[model samples]
Target: AVLGQRHEKNFRPIHYASKIITEAELNYTTTEKEMLAVVKVQLNELNELRDQAYENSLIYKEKTNRLHNSNIKDRVFNIGDRILLFNSRLKIFSGKLKSRWSGLFSISYVFPYGTVELSQPDEPSFKVNGHRLKHYFGGDRPKLVVPDLQTFPKDQ
Candidate 1:
């Protein structure tokens, strides 16, 4: 089905084309089926290259997504750790410019399957998805100081 974008950004069926496959063509492998379909459509060489390039770009996107996700370190939160919670629910007066994350909530309990119980000083505890929370550094710098490592350790 060929769809064209309409004025309201909705898709409209510009044209619809269909073809019946023969028994011999049905026997082709999945990869062969794709190439065969391109040929059966009688598209020009440029059109065929355009289609192939779209498919190749999709494969490249999948590979890049895998590599990008692999580089993201897993976040682990302890019971007492401070975290910021992501607000996914829309608010009536909240505009797009408003910050989505709202906390320095402390983790009181951690449940299985990425569920966490959070609480603040005067606020009641509430459960939220662990994926929505990120570690909060609380405006304090880490105390650990790195000693000079330029010289080799004294031969001890």
Candidate 2:
């Protein structure tokens, strides 16, 4: 009877231990599922935020393009107009006082898309971009006047 009582005591603990282990396993699986659900929600939110940022960047670029285009001044050229050509080659040298304009060229022909044919006296005519040319306001050269000096009378 004592051996029978001891056996009953050991079996009772083993059964209770198995039940506790199954409960713990169930709790762990539920916690893992909750964690996985939270991670998925966070991932979805991150993707949405990234998409919103991309859209905002595209909008910003479009506004910037429009503002830049609005500020640009259109240059117009016509035939027989005198223009000064900008000397881009002189930009390499450091000379603050030196004038970058080199030509008093006359526009012989005006082409589409900002192309212009320039002509100068005793020089071959060449084509250049209209952007490099500016209207020359100095029309005809001014004549200089010299004052006559008074002569002193010599004594005899």
Question: Number of clashing residue pairs in every model?
Answer: 0, 0
* TM value for model 2: 0.64
Model 2 lDDT per residue over 1-156, tens place = 010113745632211111123454456665564454455556767999999999999999999999999999887888889898999999999999998988688999999999999999899999999889999888763444788999989998
Candidate 2: regions farther than 4 A off: 1-28, 138-156
In angstroms, give how far residue 127 of model 1 lies from its true place.
0.4
Model 1 over residues 80-149: C-alpha lDDT tens digits?
Answer: 9989888877465669788777867899999988899999889899999999999988684344599877
lDDT, candidates in the order shown: 0.79, 0.77
Candidate 1 C-alpha RMSD relative to the actual structure: 20.4
TM-score of each: 0.48, 0.64
What's model 2's lDDT at 121? Answer: 89
Worst lDDT 10-window in candidate 1? 1-10
